[model samples]
Target: MDKKTIATALAMIPILGVNAGADSIETVSNPAPIQRASVKKTVTADVLNVRSGPGTTYSSIGKLYMGNVVEVISESGGWAKINYSGKTGYVSTDYLKSNESSSGGETSKPSGNQKSIQQVTSSILRVRSGAGITYSKVDTLHKGDNVTVESTENGWAKISYSGKSGYVSAVYLKFVEYVDEDSSGGSESSVIRGATVQRSSKSYSLDEMVEVQYIKAQNGGNLISRNNARTGEEVFTTYIIRNAEPRAYGKPTKDELRYYLDPANFEGYSSGLMQFVRLDRYTNTITADSLNKYFASKGTDCVFNGKGQAFIDAAKKYNIDVLYFVSHAMWETGNGKSALAKGQVVTSVDGVTLDKPVTVYNFFGIGAVDGNALEAGKLTAYKNGWTTIEKGIDGAAKWISDGYIHNSKYNQNTVYAMRWNYEYSWHQYATDVNWANGIATMMSSLMEKYGTGEGLLIDIPDYK
Candidate 1:
């Protein structure tokens, strides 16, 4: 309270104060903050609506885009006051991004948001009693079984099933909220609906069993199945059929190979999947209730293991291939190149950058990354650069839903990233099976290496 002391306190206010979303308090006036400077939280949402007052019912001001930075001015139980666009507003802290825009710049935290979700990841999935690892079996849920979602408990989705609340492991359900890519090109594509994909019995080669997938434009890519031709049963309320694989007549020169290898350069490497990951891992803008949707059985799942089992469980709930998801994670964290990755420095294949050369994570090439944590290093305008792998997955999901990756798919020659990159590996990569072939090939390879390859999961090739 002395004049000098008052002046010192005033100086500290600018750094200490913040405008955070709902469910959170921005400043700690009595105890003071560990560090000063209000952190600018973001709307991890692709389209976060800015509201007046402190609730969603408040009049809408404007919409916040993904990574829209805001000043955290104040906080409440689970809310934070922040500047959305040019206006001051409150948002739910449940969705408020906890990780600083900078990785390694500060210690991070998270929460539990499970048990309140009911998804159909795999058809004929089983539901259990209570949300426990040792819970008893309740019944089986076929693909497209829409059960009521409940609160997150013990890492399982507590769904209200058949007049009773039962627990369903997130692994069995893939939330149908899909990211709609703008595949404008008159290219071939297929949409698989079930949790598992089945190849017809007769066919053995890559293109044989693809009959399950419906090929759209004869651009590129093809399907493979066990049988040559068989029943057209619907998996998850959809049908998958095969088509001709695009032919990669000419080989790309060494120069073309080098271009796609670079994250900033390769069309898909940078914009396609990377964009989607950014959206998927993004935080903020969703209701606190929605936050529980991301949590697992226990707090330990989140606070440890690189956000491991919890993240795995969450992805399973969404029915995304962890390998594909993790690849993007390694891309962002630099495969440990980032200090965030335990001081492991991921390098380029040519020993240059982390994203390029080879994007690898986990035992079977998994995970994604943003860039670098906070100030470690950054990808120029990209936030969450040098950050954790999950953030990359968040970004990719967002990008895919935003139609960022599919923008260039309209024309035959337009280059695509992950959706239909003929450069990677696939038959008819350019001709008959353009986009469809590339995605199907990946799925085909996955089955060859991992599972039995029977189910509706691989039905929808990422192309068409």
Candidate 2:
């Protein structure tokens, strides 16, 4: 048969095994009062089938992958009724494991040293799949919402919300006394402080920042190579420089740049507001173990691995925030997988010749400029005697500290200031509009994972 005719016949063939009339299988209904205690579970199987009913006889409607978190509203026999993709579905309880306890029963109330209950104080708080902001958000909790505090770890409070066990920032949760059914008692107040915001003297409208970016784009800015002059004036373009030749940059629209530049766009999210945090401040809370964990989380396997102490030492020496310093290095070096980070042997660059070949490492892309990033970056590393990974890290930290964080003229200590330098528009760190945002996100992720949100000073620019 011809290809088209054969394809048509194949399409007409009915799917084999699955019963066509299986739609009549029992739909999910409200669970009985006794079975209504919601429990959070993680899928243990590589792939578990979600069905219309509780057994293999029922047809498969969807699938759940391993490590996927789901809320088990109820259980019967060996099947779990879970809220899957906005609809109810059933999966074998054998393939699921509870996040809190192995028993398929009501979540146990806190006892002993564990606090009984806590109230959400933030206008809106996100319940993450894991303890850190790097994890996906599972749900949200609103102000005044009371939740049973199962545990607290790494500045996150483990709680069951909307049938799902997830973590919310402990900073926004206040302790509330739990009263038994027979007893009546008043609740005590113990509110943990969240991020503190301070207004800066410098101010600029969103339009002014966008205009400054456009001006920089046209005048040989740090990373910007060309502009879409014919298309429109507001739109700017740059190149994404990998190890190879520079590739065409994405044309970010003026609106997109505005969104990235506007401080108000980040005010709603506690972590997002971290972009305005002063990077010059040093904290003793950061440890080598925490930095190692952060590096491992990013899947960094290069020479930068196990160099956490070097990063901490550099941060302390430069009086820079360890989180910012490490995150900036991770971003610049592609989580320590970039060519410059891995080290490159060089004897010469830009018509300049050296006496001997030296293997140089650049953990922070220090001298990486547009057009010739790789060569220039390696040369800069060699000149600075960054022959070792630790030396490279310390050297980069010193450079950044002197040039931007502690610079007398620029004083661009925060990510916001680095991007939108109100004092000197041309002295901004990067030409890429997303540079500050990306670094800030990394900083926030690290902070969320390891920081306790105590004594955080956020300097938000007050735009006129």
Candidate 3:
């Protein structure tokens, strides 16, 4: 039950060493015909120099650090010509190692079919002048922004922004295809091509959502105890409901809270959009093979394995989203490793003595509160006669459908609704601010592994 604090920090931008201007750098005269396919080379030296020409006689224009990957244009006489920050420069071939073999004689061009569209995944992505962090930043891109990727070298993606060519870390970019807005089937503005918004009576801006859901709830004399007194940077305490350990909680910084609360951050990626997906929608795409494959991918080796048919049947019987049901169960049970997931023998429940020591299973952590999660969960399972894995799955699905998905009071049929509960904010499923986001992420991950976007419906909240 120990309270944990989490902090967010910004990265320090490195200062580039630029002694000479681009105009002063000597260009390769009558350069040999470009040969070999487009190849990436990693810098082997701690600090390699980019010279105006091929030899030591050339002036040093810039410096490249170890692990920096550069696109090699051509190589001759132990010197390699490279594309340095949109300009041509030469570096010692000895200090550069080719990432792949160069066998093809065709020359590589930044134009034509090499181009692809990519969406930014990071909250704030820096566009550097070169392919490495040491290079000067040319621009900044936010989450959900789209950029045309000309090429990818090492771990950097080459993009053209603001009439200039720049490089962004490939790790922050995701390949995305454009979807026509008209095809979205809604009037609400679609944040991403595949996601559509839905108008609601109650809506809150990103800042307002964070304030009401996290800041106000935590600071407004709530009963939950904190590890430390509230500070300017640290604003909220969130319980960790997904873990098997007891009393796991976290105090997230302001920036962390805003990142999770921002709908734009999640809407940009297909998986992130799961928060707003209606969990009651029925689909035939989900199958036992797919569910079992998802479990296999997570390396889950418990009773939940081979029970995919039970989950599918429960979802069909209760009109629940099978993917969401599986994801929720996996999250609650720590991928089916928790004691409740494994089942526990009980002789008594809620002060009611039982006739015998009956074993019960709680797959979705129903009735598992913060303090007494195990006992409460077991009692609910025992009462429902969830002595078998199939029973646990079916019973938990019914509980979720009746209590949250189809509940008249809250009407929380989606992850976002389950967490925020705009109709009844106090009736949310969990105290953890990240509870909905975590489940949505898991759902997204499972979909990416085995599901497709065909017939996918996204519901974005239209904030006032």
Lowest summed lDDT across 10 adjacent residues in model 1 is found at 233-242
Q: Write the per-residue lDDT of candidate 2 for residues 306-359, one digit (tens) a residue.
A: 888999899989877787787778767767777888889997866777788889
Better of 1 and 2 by lDDT: 2
Estimate the TM-score for candidate 2. 0.51
- Clash statistics: count for each candidate: 144, 0, 0
- lDDT against the true structure, per candidate, is 0.36, 0.67, 0.66
Pairing residues by index, what is the TM-score of model 3? 0.52
lDDT of 3 at 217: 59
**Which stretches of candidate 2 lie above 4 Å from their native place?**
1-194, 203-206, 218-254, 348-356
lDDT of 1 by residue, 170-222 (tens): 43443322121321101111222112221111113223223222232222233
Candidate 1, after superposition: displacement of residue 247 in Å? 17
